[model samples]
Target: MVRKLLPPLASGFLFGMGLTISGMTDPGRVRGFLDIFGDWDPTLAFVMGGAVVVMAIAWRVQARMVKPVFGERFSLPDRTDLDPRLLAGAAVFGVGWGVAGLCPGPAVASLALSPVYAAPFVAAMLVGMLLQKLTMERKVSNP
Candidate 1:
């Protein structure tokens, strides 16, 4: 259990550090990025670009590896084609991000800095996840 938890906890810490360093832990900073016509900030784009670059490199490394440290092998998503569900989810996520200015990772990190807004943001996120699970369960049962 300790072995399983360590890597994820370490990764979360690093992710949180990145958010803090990039000023993404601040809702105001995120809101500024969302505001295109008024006091817009482009920092989030750079952060995202950097993340993409890192993910590209990491994916390459993972592909070459025979197995992961804990798991037998990585089970990546098989779907390469975009569908309506994917597009709809992206749109909903974008809208939520724009309105809340706090995605899951950063919102959890913001808690360390005592951001009161993070509580409700995190609560809503959890509720959304639960709803998605319930809907998926219903679909599976119906099908």
Candidate 2:
């Protein structure tokens, strides 16, 4: 159990540190990025570009690997085609991000740094997640 938890714990800590260092925990910074028509901030774009480059390299590495360094098998998203449900979910996500200036990662990361912003957002996020879970369960059972 300890061995299994260590990898994800370290990864999450590193991710939180990156978010803190990159000003991703700052709502104003995120909102600035979204405000393209107004005074826009392009810092997040650079951050995203860096992430893309890193992930591209990681993908290349993954292609050659038989299994993850710590895991038996790699779990990856298999879906490629966009449909109405995906589109709707994306639209909702974009709108939520724009309005709140904090997605799940940043919201969770900000808890230790900016509780004022993170707390309410995290609470609301938890509620939303609960609602989603219950709704999905209902659909699964009904179907």
TM-score of each: 0.87, 0.92
- For candidate 2, the per-residue lDDT at 17 reads 89
Residue 31 of model 1, lDDT score = 96
TM-score of model 2 (CA atoms): 0.92
Top TM-score model: 2
lDDT of 1 by residue, 1-143 (tens): 99889998999999999999999988788999888999999999999999999999999999899999778878887667578878888898888888988888999998888568799988888998999899989999999
Task: Write out the backbone clash pairs for model 1.
Answer: none
Total clashing pairs for each candidate: 0, 0
Off by over 4 Å in 1: none
The residue pairs in collision within model 2 are none
lDDT of each model, Cα atoms only?
0.89, 0.91
